[model samples]
Target: MARKTKEEAQLTRQQIIDAARAVFHESGVSRSSLDAVARVAGVTRGAVYWHFKDKTELFHAVREEVSSPLLARSHAILDSGDYADPLDAVEAAIVDFFRILEDCPTLRQVLEILILRCEYVDDFVDVKAEVMQPAFEFNERVAAAYRRAAALGTLRPGLEPESAARDTLAFTTGLLHLLLGTRDANGIREQVPAMVSAHLALRRR
Candidate 1:
């Protein structure tokens, strides 16, 4: 009956996103609906429509909300440039990355949306792109680190830096996927350190 202020509108939008995550977690993506999200958020259906064009757009928004902070942390690590060994820096980054993923329950909901919702495939691609941007940037950092290692004579002479970098990237990504799929906290604690060590073994020195 009353026009919502801009701040009220923004708050309502976030509430819907939060509620959507709850519904998604409880019932998976296919079972969740905008109407249900509106009910959970205590907002009218008209308000949800006012903020989002449709479910697809809201799904992307949820992905963005979940990823933006993780990307920012990754970017900060790259920007700070404090660590001497590039692989060491990358390892530190990976630990922090997994910790955030483990701590953020809502991310699990977001992942369910991407992986389970067969009806909205475009969101899957968009999610991949969102993930790839950071992956590419981290790959470049690894490549640079590998080049530096080779230059410092810490690596085998005449080593192919780019190839090593690619291999390291692939290895880390596999390790992360394994970590994400793993439900046991102790198992991850045991596996992640070994994975990091094996990755660092790639260093010549």
Candidate 2:
């Protein structure tokens, strides 16, 4: 057999992921079978196994693809640029996250898996932990941003930015689950920006 080129390997991996997304979207992750994903991708079962160890790993990969750009943009925004107010950076980050989910269905599926189906699974915590790393990092930045805002006297006296960031993100994650879980998955796109603005309004201006 001819050795597969790197491009070919990546194409196969993406094919599997795309197939899995279609299957999961149509029937949901809980009901979609690996065999069904394999058939959709027109690949062998062994190929799916070769690309991803199991459903969770595949889901994780999808989540990574969905969130990686947002993660990079967020880190860049927080780490660089002289902002008029540190809190503005926080608002920017929040707005970015809200907009990202509206644009990325794969990431939205990650939220759905956590809030909708994983509630009944024993390893739900594990799944949550695996997928929450990006949120945690963003919260860390929020905390640091909060401190900066506090130093500038722009933020309220008692609020803890770091802890608040963590809390706010956790709250928003749950909110996203509930909101998206009940409504048509794609419908949240039109509303997340306003929802984000409302949540940010809770902070002292």
Candidate 3:
């Protein structure tokens, strides 16, 4: 009975999180309320409060549901040191990120919420750092990879690893803005690989 209760509780928690994502995506964070989330989840308002203390906590949970997987995959790729060429690892990580974003509607919605919907003010003021932490970690990992590639004499002679890393990040940020703003998954998948390849090619020896 205890095990069944725990499983059911977990399900309810996930349902609340899913509903929060939908509500936050559609209504934006500040405008959304716990009552709305409960309605969407088909649960009592107390159920949401039982799982999350407040709207900010629930928002954090929603963000983590999507960011955690992407962060884990990136850490696995960039931290493993298993690739023959670190730049190959970098390229693979970038491509895999795009692939996941393209395949997962939940990820897309959460990303849209983070990027376009929510404002970093009032209760959300501290949330900006948490939201951006993944990007910061990603930049550090990619910079490390570029540094390793440069040591291997894989990068162009004059190219600086940190500079290359920054440039690559800029390109990626621009591409993400375009993809999210336009909701152009098909166009992104069709063109992004070649675009990423060309960007990496410029850094290669």
Candidate 4:
């Protein structure tokens, strides 16, 4: 009975999270309310409060639901030391992210909320740090990979690891904005592989 109850509770929580993502994506986080999320989830307002204290907490949960798996995959690829070239691992991780983003509607919606829908002012001010934490970690891992590539003499001469990492991050961010702005998943899929390959080629020895 206890196990069943726990499972039900978990399902309810996920429903709320999924509903919150839809609401936030459609309506923007700052303007959205717990009541609206509850309506979308087909649950009571109390159910939302039971799972999350407020809209901010609910937003965090929604973001984490999509971000955690991608971050985990990136960490595994970058930290595994299995690739012959470190930049290959970096490229593979990036390719996997874009592939998943293209295929996963939930990820696309959550990312859209993070990149375009939400504002970082008022109650969301502190939420910015939480959202950016994963990005910082991702940047650091990419920088570490660049450092390893430099040591292997595969990186372009005189290109600092940190600078290369920052450039890669900027390029990826720009592409993401372009993809989300255009809502052109097919177009991005057709273009990004070559663009990413060309970008990485410039950094190669």
lDDT by residue (tens digit), candidate 4, 39-143: 999999999999899888888899998789889998999877799899988888888788888899989899999999999999888899989888888899999
Reference-based lDDT, residue 193, model 2: 68
Candidate 1 weakest ten by summed lDDT:
117-126
* TM, every model: 0.77, 0.80, 0.95, 0.96
Model 1 residue 120 CA deviation (Å) reads 5.7
lDDT of 4: 0.90
1-205 per-residue lDDT for model 1 (tens digits): 2456777877888998888777776776657789999999999999899999887677667777877777778656744569666556666776776666667777655655554542434444444565466577777776777776677677666668788778877886776666555566567656676667777765656
Cα RMSD (angstroms) for every candidate in the order listed: 3.5, 3.1, 1.4, 1.2
Q: Kindly provide the TM-score of model 1 when superposed on the true structure, using C-alpha atoms.
A: 0.77
lDDT of 3: 0.90
Off by over 4 Å in 1: 1-4, 108-131, 155-159, 183-185
Model 2 CA lDDT for position 127: 72
Residue 126 lDDT, candidate 2, scale 0-100: 74
lDDT of residue 96 for candidate 2: 75
Q: Each candidate: what lDDT?
A: 0.70, 0.74, 0.90, 0.90
Q: Model 4 compared with the native: what TM-score? A: 0.96
Candidate 3 C-alpha lDDT tens digits along 47-153: 99999999999999999988988899987997776888988898888888888888999998999999999999987898899899998888888899989998999
- The collision pairs in model 4 are none
lDDT of 2 by residue, 119-178 (tens): 435534477776678878888887787788788887777887877777777766766766
Question: Against the hidden true structure, what lDDT does model 1 obtain?
Answer: 0.70
